[model samples]
Target: MQVFEDWNQKVKKTFNATNPEVVLTVSEAGSLLGLTKDQMKLYVDKNKLTKVPIMRSVHRYLLLKSEIDSIVKTR
Candidate 1:
């Protein structure tokens, strides 16, 4: 699947489509980046994706869609 499509599916599966700009969960981000869970965590640790804290001790990532679109184009 295309990266954007994959990302949308992941988001829907993991966290319902409350909003497109809504922060994606880690799993969704991984799918978007085409990375494994471990790699996704590493990217979080390395600050590749901006981390945003959520309620009840959960966290989410805010990814720039434009930035991702650029990467997709290059690939």
Candidate 2:
């Protein structure tokens, strides 16, 4: 039964396509960059990072995972 459950989980993951582009929320990205969420917001604006805007929300957005990876690599 445990093995079956594990296999089922794997199958579900394979079919799940919720995050096709991979994104990080403000808090998540901020933690990675050692900044507070508000500080991160300012950094995003100052750096002109790509923001994946949420539907009907002007202030909420997600940052591209690829961009964050590149920033990490450079630093």
Candidate 3:
């Protein structure tokens, strides 16, 4: 029954106020790294970056803002 479905699913995707971590799209992250979107994809693979995959989708993901910041400081 619809009532039995998880109430969490009913929540709005835009409602992420509780989550403290920030995420960035590939293009945004690429800009911060001084690399094109395509190059960033390659860099992610070569560096084994953790990709936050989108639900019901492939070939798309988000990167943690903190992780990118650390990399910038180190590299």
Candidate 4:
């Protein structure tokens, strides 16, 4: 099985290189991380999270589901 960082790299590359259609919105990402929307936004602003810019003033954060799951498991 792939590690979280490896999976995150794959997803980031897919977004930046292939430009996929199914990127997660901030809200969706927050749900995965067990974080509130505001907290997620804070992480985005701090560059702790990766957000892909899809269109004019529109962006979505990319998060590995496994990474979030790991966080929940550890917590």
Per residue, candidate 3 scores C-alpha lDDT tens digits across 1-75 of: 345643222222332354576677777789999999999999999999988776656777778778899999998
* Predictions in order: lDDT: 0.58, 0.75, 0.74, 0.58
Instruction: Point out where model 3 deviates above 4 Å.
Output: 1-18
For model 1, which pairs clash? none
Compose the digit string of candidate 4's lDDT tens values, residues 1-75.
955665444555667566543455566667776778788888667755445553333444465444455556876
Better of 2 and 3 by lDDT: 2
lDDT of candidate 3 at residue 18, scale 0 to 100: 42
Error of 1 at 6 (Å): 18
| Candidate 4 pairs with clashing backbones | none
Q: Estimate each model's TM-score.
A: 0.47, 0.73, 0.74, 0.45
Off by over 4 Å in 1: 1-20, 58-75
| TM-score, predicted candidate 4 vs. hidden true structure | 0.45
Q: Judged by TM-score, which candidate is best?
A: 3
TM-score of the candidate numbered 2? Answer: 0.73
